[model samples]
Target: MISMDEFIEFVRGGPLGPIKKWGTKWSLWPVHLVTACCGAELAHAFACGYDGERIGALNYGIARQTNLIIVEGAITRKMAKVLRITWEQMPDPKFVIVMGACGLQGGIFWNGYHMVKPSDVVPVDFFIPGCPPTPEALLRGIRQLQFKIETGEAKTSATFPEVPLEAGRKPRVLPKSPKKISKAPAVIVNAPKEVDWEFGQKLVEEIKAKVEAKSVTITGKNRIAVKVESDYIPRAAMRLREMGFDHVKNVNVIDVPNEDKFIVEYHFSSYSVKELMPVIVNVFADIPRENPRVKSLASMFPSADYMEREMHDFFGVIFEGNPWMGRKFLLAPDAPEFPLRKDFKLEEEVYVR
Candidate 1:
């Protein structure tokens, strides 16, 4: 294995160093991680005579010999893990080119729960900003990467200057907006005020009747924060389902380091309960963060499949009963540790062996 000092010397002085100048001038190999909608322009970059290969830049399969990772677009929390792991797996002297606005910040998914900034995981070499760049724009990015390599510039610090995206352009080929469907006639003019279900009352009764936890606190309208013993979440979820809640809308866990407890919260709502339409019930439990563990709700809410995976990704809070809870999800596999907690600041740099 190459020692750190020898690796640095090889990067600066070997045959690898001399070839970089000429290779960058003619051989730009872009490894496509066609993550989202921006793949169209990426395809155009290599298509007939817009032919990226003519300039000696070719698209290659991800192999250790390959050193470029071009992030196409929106990487869901699940894919974020993949990006990180892939970065770690590539050989050293690797470079990253972040393509499109979505890859930078989450783009239209800015407020989406299942997202992490690409730069947060790996040191980005360049960011090509557009919803989907044109073939010419993609070629320009390759040229820029080659220029940087030729100049012996640091691959991790090259920044792509900002360009505004065109307004009102559809990112996907599908219709810009869904066609309006006819409204139901039953709730038209003079509709009676909707009956509200006392979800809180029903929830409390169900918990009291079924769960033997320490204390269940009710907080916020349509929200109940339960402080159950860690072992009973599965039972609580089953009881909540029996009480008519059908889906889990969000699964969030807050780490309270001061109290040495992780506040595990699962927000649940119902499809079968008409009167409970707007009500949302939040079931919470506290567990020690060091050994933070909770029952998986995938059985009760199939929609929570990815949510649990994401929570497991950032908090290091294991869902003991979850089917999929291994490796990276929102953060890269190369990331040092759980990053969402208050303690894990992005500015800190610590070398990992």
Candidate 2:
């Protein structure tokens, strides 16, 4: 749309030209869009040993000042929105570097319903693949980005091509689920493992006697899984509390869509009891997916309060006694409903006044 002189000036980066390229390449400040375990690896790159200041890519908190975005680790549905918003805020001549196996293909969260690829969210210049990529490797990615900035060598698969859209199709259509969805492997957390922990036997026996659970098995060295009925979660929590398992370390909800159930688990561990401090007891229960309701253990284990609200928001799992139920907690008010569920489909919600 511009004249020949204008086009030449644009290609030459206005007046500064090579000086601009040189400045941009060296002074590539990064704004982090990090999540999960890969955040630690990103921190190590900026830590005492590696020295990120020397690399000339010091992390900035705000988006406008930074030219680079280091998207570290798994990008969820919610995080994808944040990534786009942050990327849009940057001034000009921006670059994206996704650093982790999770950012590319989900890694440990391999078939997760909520997982969103970093490349799908933004134009990624480099992808450093590892469970968590090393500091040296991340440094190399930054250097490559710098190289691309200065030299304009657009490597194959490094950046996205601006594809012309088809006439009838809308961008960012959600993928259709397979006609027949298979049930996930039932034995994830409670898979019985025979470890040489003699103490586990007595501990399991004690827990079994106290809590009327369907199955009580040692999953790992110091890990015991106690699965009770949905109605019996409160009773089981109280019984575990009486037996020195004082607090809830973690509360999780696993969606088993094909089975028409949701597995709710509370990882109970002891702080006051020194002997039991090393051990972790995972008490879990299954709930009907259609009518997901269970007794909340927030009163019994205060730590379960926030997680219960989070689960409610993500999967629409109602914890009957939790006061914070029937409201948004972790997710935005406009976010897709029960997004973590396996059969989640994107649908437009309309309101009539």
Best by TM-score: 2
**Candidate 2 lDDT score relative to the true structure:** 0.86
Best by lDDT: 2
Candidate 2: where are CA atoms >4 Å away?
1-64, 67-77, 80-201, 214-221, 256-259, 332-334, 345-353
**Candidate 2: Cα lDDT at 32:** 88
Residue-by-residue lDDT tens digits, candidate 2, 132-242:
889988888888887788889955334677998799985575555445546566646688999999989999999888889999999999999988898998999899888
lDDT of 1 at 329: 66
Q: How close to the true structure is residue 19 of candidate 2, measured as C-alpha lDDT?
A: 85
For each candidate in turn, the TM-score is 0.47, 0.57
Q: Compared with the true structure, what per-residue lDDT tens digits does model 1 show for residues 1-353? A: 99999997896778787776676567656678887888888888889959888877888986565788889998776687788888888886788988898998778877455567889888988888777777787788777787787886744334689999799976755333343435333311111232343666676677778766666555556656555667887787788788777999999888776666677878878888896667676677778878988888887689887898988888888997787776776565555567777456433223332
In candidate 2, the residue pairs with backbone N, CA or C atoms under 3 Å apart (3 or more residues apart, or in different chains) clash, namely none
Worst 10 residues of 1 by lDDT: 185-194
